[model samples]
Target: MTVTDTEVSGRRYTVHNPATGAEIGTVPDCGPDDARAAVDAAAAALPGWAGRTAYERSAVLHRAHGLMLERAGDLARLMTIEQGKPLRAARNEVGYAADFLSWYAEEAKRVYGTLIPSPRSDQRLLALRQPVGVVAAITPWNYPISMITRKVAPAVAAGCTIVLKPAEQTPLCAIEVFRILHDAGLPAGVATLLTTSDPAPVGDVLLDDHRVRKLTFTGSTEIGRALAARAAATMKRVSLELGGHAPFVVFDDADPKHAAKGAALVKFLNAGQACICPNRIYVQRGILEPFLETLVARVAGMRVGDGLADGVAVGPLIDEAALAKMERQVADARAKGAEVLLGGARATGDDLAAGHFFQPTVLTGITRDMDIYHEETFGPIAPVIPFDTEAEVVELANDTRYGLASYVYTRDLDRAVRVAEQLQFGIVGVNDINPTAAAAPFGGVKDSGLGREGGPAGIEEYLDTKLVGISVAR
Candidate 1:
């Protein structure tokens, strides 16, 4: 059964499994009217939701988290079917998503106000946080459940009502999430979900509507910029987690095999569909050859098939468009003289012919002229480039307009610290590939996107700070 009975806009659209081109289910092809309704619902519910105490807000989120854990197995299977990640990865995503809700549940009670000493003895000063009102959250297809939870959890925790628009490609997982929230006692209209194929019209309505006080998005940088421009007219607050061309660097002191292994594991996560996946690899010249060899070998051994199939480490790309993009990127690199040291093309046998499957690929002899050198390769291909020194690698890494996240593998404490500091990205991983945690802030600087998500700061994104001053003796 479908998760919702809400009025759908326009026609019904069928969602397909990228791995087998099989029809999974249909969702309402929502449009602007549906978007408006969701916004209206949130606006109507805002006062009551925002008026609730932090403890009350936290209690609902905690219930949702518990419900999520109780349904983890079902949600994970559904996620794997629609989103096309390995079943194990899907299970982990569900758990991580639940953690976000649970973490924000606790954080709600900790949104402390500040008191300040006044310059005048008889005056008083105070700073307090209040909900930013209605929030419009747009999430991507890559990490469906977590992206939604990451944005929704904090907004609700901050006493804000939300209207969520999940990517059309993966609405089932999101629908399930909202169902859990509803079951957890989230008041109707406090949280609403809209599944739509065309988001521009919907986004336009949300951005133009004065009722939406804040907007949070996880998608391409291009879309993020467009949304930001639209939000500008309304002067609404926005938090964007956009595209990333993350760098994975290995210094001479690091173990080439270990660095390569870590890099390989991270690059292949979600079939390299994640925004923070490493797009480029920079290895010190002294260890370049060994690193490349190990990376190629590691990638060579990974299994590529349906996400639900046993032992399948990599799954299909989201759709044919993604597969074509990967094809073009690899073709562009090959034409520019980058050697295809490992799997470099789409998988073909009867077992994989119907699927949007690309083999886990590794390319070396990369140069600045190659497209993969700068563009975000949202596929299972790792482009290995060599650097002569720390200064050169740092310069090369920071040259891109994106500053989302970067990784550095080095045992030298001073070098690691220096490089980490020098890197322009918002989050840096030293000797580790995964830098994310529920307690740490994530987001980027420069063109990668703006504002922050996760951590204590995440709640702030959904809140407005107000200062009060009183003349006690005037």
Candidate 2:
């Protein structure tokens, strides 16, 4: 009952560690009334928070940034327990989360307005940026802490009060973030945090209320679409960071070992639950053999176990559903003539028996018929599909409905620039595996989602432009 079931009469939902299948904590099952109250609190705090000088708000955010780094160790450990990423990776995520707060602190002061040239000497025209008011931010479970800061920091920096609902599986991480913000001198009611297993009631309140001026969400595309539709009812400003079927293209000129090394590093990150992790890796046919050899060797070296264990390169999948999805993808691939180049099944060991553990798998001979080729595999499975030419590869890569992220590795500058430009993805990495940063725009085009986060573009999402004209006294 503590971690398995959501009872009808129970007021709380328990959170369990996927690494060990043990109960970690419980959170209240918030409903419509709690959501309404949160909106009220945020609305009441808006004028005061928004009225503060950008310098004053920046000071608070700067303090929060410092606190995040000072308490990073505890935060990382807590993330490892709740989100199941390896300890080292969790530490990196905490640092990444802190950078957003730091970046937005500077941006708070940089929210500039412009004075337009007037047609008449006696008249003045001005363009100003104003806070959009209360925001509804919903975050997913993966990279729990980072997602919160990515959305919440920018909104608060723009002087918008927020009501955030963290994913049910990771409320404690959100609670910790609120604590840091409060300690950093953020006024009460400026940010309201809600925990809920039944999200429909809360979601309804957020989308239906005109008081919640904006809605920001990070999750799957299916749910993102639904939320966007709901937000349309009230014309709320919406930002959705949804699913990605990313492609990693490796040209023949690139070193096979280098490409494989980068592939292995990013593919198994958070056990590949990340949206931007490459779903399909396209290596030129001339160099496919060497790349496959190196990739298999590196993939075989990955150690899958509990996140707290030292030297564990890969951690457990979030739950049984994720583990089953991984198995089903592999099963579908094998049934349709895909070859398993490396670990293809669940990690079987006494230590991992209780948890949802999947071995890092590599599949070759991927065809259009295989489920892994057409579907988004948010798990530790790398499907390497060989292509003959740059043109063919680009076509294959861009065939999916998603256009969030893409990667290209090439020694030839011409090919790198050409392929990156023609790829049609929002974020493209040239000879790089990771393309995310606090001061860089991050989002997608097409069905991937709408709006951007991180960098200067992020804070803009929480602001509305106001135009003013005045006639001077004659």
Candidate 3:
């Protein structure tokens, strides 16, 4: 069973498990008409949803969060089948996804209006927050459930209807989320989920439709820009969490072993598929060797196999294209003389042969000329670069156009604060690898895209501020 009995957009398409090269299931191959229908449904439902009191909407989101927790194991298994993260990671993600619903459920009631003192007697000034009408959300394959929940939860919690187009590769997991929402008493048409192999037509309709007042996207920067451009025609509110080439910086004062362990753990989380994962690790020249050695040994001991397998710390890449991309990046680095200190080739075993597996890899002597240093390596490969001074490391880290998440490791309070302030990235983790939470804002500056997600600001992305002024009639 899936989210709805809504008729397919002409046909259905197969969804495969990247871990096994096997078909898990099929979903509706939604297209333009489906997109239009979803938007129309959302627009129609917006008034009723928006008219509801904050408490009323909060009730539904709270119910959904509870249901998510109850069905977590099932959802996690489904995620592993389609999205291919380790089962443990999938379970954790399920909780994280539910956290958004819980967070926004409370945030709903906290959407307070402001009353301002009028300049003249008998005059009144007020600021109000209201739902931004219909929302069109597009989420990526990586972190499918949380991405959807973050967008959908806030929009619904803010009393807005939504039309979600989850990535084709991981639509099944999204279906389960939609089903949970529906069962949680979300009114029909208040939330529409369109699973599709072809997104161009759907995205086109969503962007072109005037009914969609807001567009929230979590995917590639290229696609986000294109969508934002088209959405401009309708003056749609846009929020984008795009591609990241996050740099993990370690200063000389930092514990080399601790920093390396942190690097290995974070760099391999989700098999390095996360947008926040470090693309480049910069270590102070004094501690570079120890960091590299610890990083190499730890990553070398890590296990890689099917996400469902016992003790498998890492899982397969999403598909052959991802594997090929990792191969090319590593090849480019090797050709440029970077040392491959650990596994640098595709993992091959009878159990892993059919999967899109890449061995956890580590490379040192990374230079600006290497592709891994420049491009975001969305795989289990860690590239280490050495730096001498804070100014030099900060410059090297901020060299990329992307300014999403970045990390810095140092025991010195002044250095931690200084480097974090100097680094031109959003959501810097000073001595902490995972700084994201339901209460803190997550976004980027520069080409990393615009607007913010999570925290109190997340719901604001789905809200519009209105001002009211009254003049004396006497």
Per-model TM against the reference:
0.98, 0.97, 0.98
Question: Per-residue lDDT tens digits of candidate 1, residues 1-474?
Answer: 111356556567889999998999998877887878888788888899888998998999999999999999999999999989999999999999999999999999999889999889998999988899999999999999999999999999999999888999999999999999989888888888888777788788899999899989999999999999999999999999999999999999999999999999999999999988999999999999888888888888899999999999999999999999899989999999988988889998897988899999998888898888889889999988888988999999998999998999999999989999999999999998888988889999998898999999889899889999988976
| Candidate 2 per-residue lDDT over residues 64-89, each given as its tens digit | 99999999999999999998999999
For model 3, what is the C-alpha lDDT against the true structure?
0.90
lDDT of 3 by residue, 1-474 (tens): 222356545689999999899988877888787778788788888888899999999999999999999999999999998989999999999999999999999999999899999878989999999999999999999998999998998899888999999998998888889999989999989999988888898788888888889999998888889888999999999999999999999999999999999998999999999999999999989998888889988998889998898998999999999999999999999999988888899999999989999999998877789888878788999988888989998999999999999999999999888888998998799889889987789899877889998999999898888999989786
Off by over 4 Å in 3: 1-4
Sorting all predicted structures by TM-score, with the top scorer first, yields: 3, 1, 2
In model 1, which runs have C-alpha deviations exceeding 4 angstroms? 1-4, 8-10
TM-score of candidate 2 on Cα atoms, chains taken together:
0.97
